[model samples]
Target: MIREGVMNQAQKLLAGLKIPALQAPMFLISGPEMVINACKSGIVGSFPTPNARTPEILDQWMAEITEQLSSAQNPAPWAVNLIVHPSYPRLEADLQVILKYKPPIVITALGSPKNVVEAIHSYGGVVLADVVNTTYAKKAASAGVDGLVLISAGAGGHTGYLSPFVFVNEVRQWWDGAIVLGGGISTGKNVFAARAMGADAAYLGTRFIPTKEALCVDEYKQMIVEASSDDIVTSDAITGVKANWLRQSLLNAGLDPDNMTAKGKIDFASNGADNKRWKDIWAAGQGVSASESVSDVSSIVNLLAREYVSAASELTQTLKPGNRE
Candidate 1:
């Protein structure tokens, strides 16, 4: 039997899915199409608030998505991502829009605020906060976040340096609300590994860049398809934030991956003040090496489910007969 705490959280999140996997809300890549497809597949889907340029547009998108899903009789829960940084001038305005819709889940990144958590809870919505280390996890927990997403090493944009083993182990030692493990998780075996390490689910971003529902450019998708672990580079030069990127993309953009220097400034307003460079920079995690093709979201999820079942069966076989340890 599943642990009562874990089961309750998983049931709340799964929304009838067999596995606990969420398509991490990519900055610009995650859109309504992607979220819709993931939800249709019975997995949690999400998109960032900034994906919409105005509060009016955000409200329209939420209404359309809610209506479309309800009409289809699909019960999978959807989430909205909020950039809790003060730099986002429209944070409060966007929060107001989110309040009107009350998505089943709200994912807060960059910073977690007590009031934000309180607001979501007031509507019976769950709040999941993304944290890079134990320190941030503790801070989010203190803020009353319902779940902690451990963005461990090998993850895509804005990743952490801790191994999932160390990160999850440390967090589980104290906090026990709900935990999701991220970073280099591209396969079913990885999902099993995360659960074994005490995570309630796997958060995936880079693995979905090549999916048909993603809003990435063709060149970007091709790069992910062709690259491997050795082809990725971690640097803070592009966004003034340390993140993993495809090394070939850096070289293609005429930058030396080996000798790149940090500009020591984060210009969220540079590149036409529209976040254009990030579109070309191409963010991916160490697990891109495991991706073999660019397929649709449904196909990718089907493949992952197949592999997960096969892995579970193999584990059962290993423990049966005289093959047990």
Candidate 2:
């Protein structure tokens, strides 16, 4: 049976869905087209506000996604990811737009989202915060966020080093609100594992990076396909935030992954959409090794759905109650 609080935000939000998964709001990569496909395929789609480079463009994206997804057949709820930190100069303005439209879900990153909780709550939107540890998860719970996304090791971009198993268990001890597990989730079996581990759903990023709908360069997508876990390097070098990047991308930037001088600062003002910051320094996860080729969102979701059902059936025989070895 599904847990009690697990159905609070996630269930109401995703009332009727094929798989309980949310395509992570990747910076620059997740745009209108990608978000549209994810929703069209009966999954939550999202994108970061700063990916538009300007608030005006963000407004356009919001309008486009809202119109398209709302009219789509049996569309799933969509979300917007906001960097709720002081460093982002346009946080207030971008948040204004979000509060205006009020997508079903709002995901906050970088810092506490307590300040916006009241406003977001006013519009009946659920706020989900990204947390790496119990500290941030408790902070988000105190802030009245509807859910928490545990970003653990093997996740792409600004990932945590903790194991998802340990972090999820720790968070559950204090809070039982909606929990979304991220990192190392590349397939449907992984999503099932997340739910079994007490998560309401799973959040995936790198798996979507190589998809056809993503707004990424062909080279970056191909690099994700060609690389593996060892090809992923974690360091606070790219954006002054500890994140995973493809080692080959570092080589293309004329830097050695093992030893190099990295001068990373929080430059929220700069645009990395098509420039060296992101274009040359690709952000990926250890799960990139699972990405075999470039495909569409629907195809990937279809494969995940099939895999999830198969895994669930297989677990009935081996992971049943009192069957532990």
Candidate 3:
């Protein structure tokens, strides 16, 4: 039986949808338009705090989204991402803004603080912390987070390097809360696979970069459409944190993919906050190779939903007793 808290949170998350798929909050790619589109498509949409240049701007964005959605009948719920890292400097201030808006969900990344979780909880907001491994997952769970996003291998921007199979299974063994499996989950079949591996939802990022609502540059979106899994490179040279990136972007920036080295220091001050080192260094997961076209968010969602249903039906048919004959 599902725990009461987990069941309540899951019901809230999956209220307008049949399956669990969240549009992962991409560092620079996710924006108000993208979030709005995702929510309209019956999925949870999110944007990181840093995506807003200032606290006032953040408030404006939130107000606009809230007003627009409220006017629409049966509007889907939305989320905002908070970078809990100490280096962020403005985390406290951003948290205040989040409290004012009180989004239905708040996704915490990089680190988790007891006070932050408490503040969000005080407002009846659910906290979903992103973790790259079992250790972080346990730590986040211990902090009383409502859910955990498992950032497994091949994920874009500050990613983890473990397979979903190993990562999700280990977390499920101890925690019964809402768990979202991240990484190379671009297609609907991948979403089914995540559920099969005991994940409550699939966190998708790279695939949405090609969507029309995303804030990615035209060139970047085209690159994702043209590239394949083999074109992705994982390294810490750009952000001082291990993340998957497009190899073509590296080559275009005059760097050799095979000779890339770690920056040797952890700079949590945003990917290219200072001098724009990561501006040209495009981040992408191994799943980009599967994205063959640029489509609107609705089209992408519809196609994935159809694919998911078809795959599930095929699996059920195969499981029937007479099918074996």
Stretches > 4 Å off in candidate 1: 1-11, 267-274, 320-325
lDDT by residue for model 2 (1-325), tens? 2355445764467546779899999986999998889989888999998888788999998999989987889898889999987777888999999987789899999999999989998988999999888888888889999889999999998898899999998887877678889998999999999989988889999999988888888999999999989999998877888889999999999889997457578666555533458767889988997789999898999998999999999988787577766
For model 2, the local distance difference test gives: 0.87
The model with the greatest lDDT is 2
Candidate 2 stretches with Cα past 4 Å from truth are 1-6, 260-263, 271-275, 319-325
As for TM-score, the candidate ahead, 1 or 3, is 3
The residue-by-residue lDDT of candidate 3 on 1-325, one tens digit each, is: 3454546474457535545788889877888888888888877889998788788999998998888778765656789999887788779888989999899999998886556988988889889999988888889988999888999898987789998899887887778888888998988888888877887788899989988888768899999999988999889887778888899999998999898885746655654563255567899998897688888877887777887888788888879697766
Q: Cα miss at 201, model 2 (Å)?
A: 0.6
Local error of candidate 1 at residue 119 (angstroms): 1.0
Across 1-325, the per-residue lDDT of candidate 1 in tens digits comes to 1245444553467536656788889987888888888878767889998887788999998998798778755547889999886566777899999999999989898776666988888888888999999989989989988888999999998888998999998998888777888999999888877877888888889888998888878888889989889988998888767789899888887889998796535644342453666766778999997678888877877787888788888888778677665
Candidate achieving higher lDDT, 2 or 3: 2
